[model samples]
Target chain A: MTDRTPDDLYDALRDRLADYGQEPPAPLWAKIRAQLPPPVAAPQLRRRRRRPIVLLGLLLTVLSAAGWQLWLVSRSGPAVMPAPQTVALGSNAPTNAAVASPASAGPSASPKLGKAALENPGMSGASISETKSSPSTATTDNLRLATQVRPDSAASRRSGPYRPQPAGSVAGPFAGGSQARNPRLAVLSRSARVRYSAGQPSLAVGSTDSSVELPTAAAFSTSGSEQGRLPVDVVVAPSAGGHKAVERSTAPVFGPVAASATDYAPGAPASLLASRPVAVLSPALPQPRVQLRTDTFSTAPAVVRRWTVQVLAGPTLTHQHLGAEPASDPSLPTGIITYLDSIVNEFSRRERMSTGYSAQVQVRRVLTGRWSLSTGLGYQEYASQTTYVASTSTSTPPILSSGVFDMAPPSPHRSTYRFLTVPIRFGYALGQSGGRLRYGLLAGIDAALYLGGNSAGKEAVPTAWSISGSPYRPLSASVSLGLDFRYRLASHLEVLAQPTATYFLNSLPRPLSGLTPHHLFGAGALLGLSYEFR
Target chain B: MPPPIAPVDEALLAACRRGESAAQYQLYQRLAYRLLGVCLRYCPNRAEAEDALQNTFVKIFTRLDQYRGQGPFEAWARRIAVTTALHAVEQHRLRHPTPGTDPDDLAADLPSAEPSALESLAAEDLLALLNTLPPGYRTVLNLYAVEGYSHQEIAELLGIAEGTSKSQLARARRLLESRLATQHYQQLP
Candidate 1:
């Protein structure tokens, strides 16, 4: 044999071993198959099933809220009438303002101007001219109250300004109860508009600081009275009995004057009971009227776009796979890779779901009526426990030699992974937009970039095994689905609860050699506060 | 020499990604022979080499998703086999260290083998000579000489100093020379 240089030897080894081949043992296949985990269900296939269920649930929530709003609209009815009360009119002089006596007539009546020889110009049923009777001098300057009360007729229920009846068609106010005996006298003035609600007369007027209820026979029919500085005479004729003196007292009644108990005779007509409290005023009030118009009470619906910023934090449940290296002895029943696994049952232990947490700041903008787009940045952390059985022997032995184990091994317990997340989400609000409480469905893509990580355990000795290097991809993305529930706590602040589910679009790289790669599935609920810009 | 291993089919890899059992088996069948050759170069014996082969396949099937299609699938699989075999060698050394022949303290004074002796040896003879060396020497030799790895890369892979990798490779060559000399003399007798 001739001598060879070190370079020649290396070259020879390289050239000769380049085409090396060996027959694998027959049992190798069986061993490998036994060791492999069950076939993984394709993420896409599972994802397809998951997406529809969430969409269906979101649709149902939206539909249910819409249906409820419709039901409420359909069940609406007219304005409710108020209870009856007696009212008294006060004046400085003894005037000949006679009350209209309607036995079967409703509250509405035609206002006829009487050729009054008295100071007051005109009088009508349920019409109180505050300008003439008001005790205050300031109110006398700009205030004018010429009102006409109408009965509940088809024409009266029609919503509009009051219209005057034809002149000389009926008896005037000076005609007393003679002309108003016919219940068809539904007359009103043309300058102001008023509607009676809940017994308090709703008065609309221009530049008027105060309003008083109409003085009606129905108001005086209830038997109650109060002391007053001014004296006034009120006479009510019962529809059944002949004209009985309702109040013929000379007593000074400055406040409300009610009918005496004798006026409520057993045979008295209850025609006023069918009457809703009526207070009508002329529509021709001054320009820029502060008076309430019942026809203008219904407002048009408006669309509002909102922008919000939110901060969210919550606990998370993470599902991942931390597979172990193949066991040195493949014949071992459990197929554990080492004593570390032998002690921990790492196969099942690593498969257990772990708990984690995350916090994020988000900005959401309403794109239009019910759709919104959201983007946010966040930090997330997940911790998994791994047991490492380290050898405590200090003697560094030669190659292919066993170590001297003088003491028991220490097991390191936990490995933690942290990520920073950027997410872009599209949202569809589930319920009515104008309500204090609302729900929405969100679908998004969340990109998670791996941050730093560390392992924690009792390190009694420098073991051969340790957690080092980047086992996970630097960047990964996930499909995120969430249900967002929010309640408005103030004009610009809201409380939020968002339950989320995330499926990683790709798998996490293995942390240890011979371990399987795994995808991460996470579910969490985030409670947060949102501030909206008006 | 055995027929060159065929390049892995893309459809087979896609099917494997979908977790098809038949595709996994087919992939295993295609790569097993070549990977076993890699394992044998690092391992001390056939049983241990087969163990490494089993580990290599398990890793391949489980982590096949990591393959980004940047290179040939066969090359990726071969890299896995090499790493697995190296890990096996490390584990064996830790469990059963040779007392006097520390890999770091290997003899540098041994005579180099004759070039004519190496030229006369077949690939099988070369592999047999490689098996006689210590695990550390075998590892360094396989990585540096046969696998075309640099000293720095071998050092990183084996968790040793770069200088140590060079010394180990030098010692492994001298040991191979000594073994070939003994075999040639025994044949002369």
Candidate 2:
């Protein structure tokens, strides 16, 4: 044998080699046959199981609603205003000074006064009266009286005799000099002479002696007057056994005025008067005294609206990021992105039914003021229906043990079945701060667990006449591309919706035998609600 | 074609198709030893061979229907097994590209220092020589000299040109021959 070819050498070696005497495991055939999917059952059977579940859900919903209604009814109560510890004057003062003028002077003024007095009782005695005047004698008299009385009241109230000056005496100078005077102007101008009651600060300008409580109060006066004005007095006075006074003065004098004695007792009515010329004034009115520490003045906390729940079902929800870090060494081989896509597709088909009630929780980091990146996990449970066909042949000998054999019968059957699936997916989200709708792309792996179903057991059978089965298998790998739509429900929570299409990288076993490898395409719709701490 | 004799063992195949648990166990037991032999030829060590055998069976059972019957049933199954083994080998190569001394040199050195004579070498010793070749050369040699594949066929199957296939086979043969020559020389000592 002069130079044998490599093929010849190999053939000789092959002939010399020992055989693989091992047989396939005894039960392998049984296991393979069992992989064949079962026949489909009647639709009526599935409907029978679903009806009771639906009815139970409805019943639970109705009962929950009734319980909530009863709870609300039991908790209902009368609405009462909370009383402040220190009711400063002007708590209920009109927001607009101009609007408050006519309203305060009209019939509405009576009820407002009573309510204010009842609510505050500190400034009930302070009477506000309007005046008109001429320019000549009004100046000398108004100035002299305002100057003399203010010192005496200030000194006496600070020292021994706490005599309350008439509201007219104190308001005289500024009110007289002012051309246009509001009725409430007098009460504010003469605020210094309006003595407060013993127990608390209460302005008593007149002899009405009624108790008044000013929750918030302010005074306005003209700067034209040479003499400095007194500080406005805000008071809360006690009343039941109070002295009364009448509204005696309402004169529009344009001449010089006489100085009158200022005497005040607890719970006396407040009043104002003027004898004057043109008093052009600035619009600097005293700010209403408000109880700064009370809850009433506090700002309301931000609220999360329920309608944001709709975002959870919107059409976009997915993320994009590599599962593993890129290879550091360029020389080291890298797999294509298509490989992941194929895996995702196969996985989605294997768990196709797991889309009905998917929920996800995600946490994202703010990359910038306007954008953030998010990654999280999700789970879904869904049901799917599948139909399969199977063929079988049986061999039997003739009834009698004869040489001739009888032909065996061939039988064919078709069946439909349902499967329950649970799929777990991990993905990322790109978010924007002020955008109406947040959007992103997601790429991740999903592992599906066949929960309960007949579909998992299905196996592909070959049409070949070979005694051994085809060699294909069914552990699916897939890659998917999906869109993530995020709807902001509140400050921290968002609704996410994702619609995805995936291509299976590996061919899955067909429900029936003798089929060619076909691409399995799966599309899924997922809705999830998430609350992010970041 | 005489009703195309069933390509697979029907009873065993049926059991697997039915997802029978017992059948799976039986199938694993029956095919494991033979697959293990195939795996051993491609793997550098016993541990790697066992892993390849397990993986091969898994792929075989999972993708059973992909076999289209262009070849013998055994050939198709063996192809799957061999592919699985090669995949494992590729992975190993990726992880440890420079796995110390080249197996060819190691085999030649082993016999050079040993007292054993080449003419008295046992079957096990021959197998050891075959194992000492590098993964690429060993795989080609086995496919060409043991599995009876033509150089052209090996080239197509391995995604290499026919010339590369021939060169690799020649290199593998030269290494083995050198190791045998060293063993023969050491015997003179």
Who wins the lDDT comparison?
Answer: 1
lDDT of 2 by residue, B1-189 (tens): 012223456577556545455665666655665666677777787767765665555545544544444666556666656655665676677667674665445445342222233335654565676687777788888777766566755654455667888888877766766676776676666
Q: What does candidate 1's lDDT look like per residue over B1-189, in tens digits?
A: 344667787799888866688999989878888889999888888888898889888768765755656578877787778867766776776667667756434444544457567777877787888887887788888887877777755654555677888888777777788777767766674
lDDT of 2 by residue, A1-534 (tens): 122373443443344332322233445334433433332344653665466456545644564465445433332322222221111111001100011122122333323322222222223222122111222122333322221222112222222221223444432222211112222322232111221111223322121222222211122123222111211221212111112100111111111111111122212233231221122221232222211111110111101111122223222222112223221222211221122223222322333232234444444433322223343444333333222211121110011011111112322221111112112233344655486578777554333222322222212111232212322222233456677677777776777777876554444333332223433344667677766542
Error of 1 at A223 (Å): 24
TM-score of chain A of each: 0.36, 0.25
lDDT of 1 by residue, A1-534 (tens): 022235777787777786587778787898888877656678864775466456545644564455445433432323321212112221211122222222211122211211111112122222222221222221211221122212112122112221111222111111122111222222222212222222433232321221222333344333243211111222222112111111211111111221221122222223331121111121222111112111111111111225689999999887665434432334322321343233223322434466788888998866555667677799877655444433322221111112322223335444556788877777889878799999999898777777856432111122222122343556677789999999999988999998998877766553332334456677999889999875
10 residues in a row with least lDDT, candidate 1 chain A: A169-178
Q: For each candidate, give its TM-score against the true structure.
A: 0.48, 0.31
- Could you tell me the interface RMSD of model 2? 18.4
DockQ of 2: 0.06
Model 2's CAPRI class? incorrect
lDDT accuracy of residue B125 in candidate 2:
63
In candidate 1, stretches whose alpha carbon ends up further than 4 angstroms from where it belongs are A1-6, A40-44, A47-534, B1-3, B94-111, B185-189
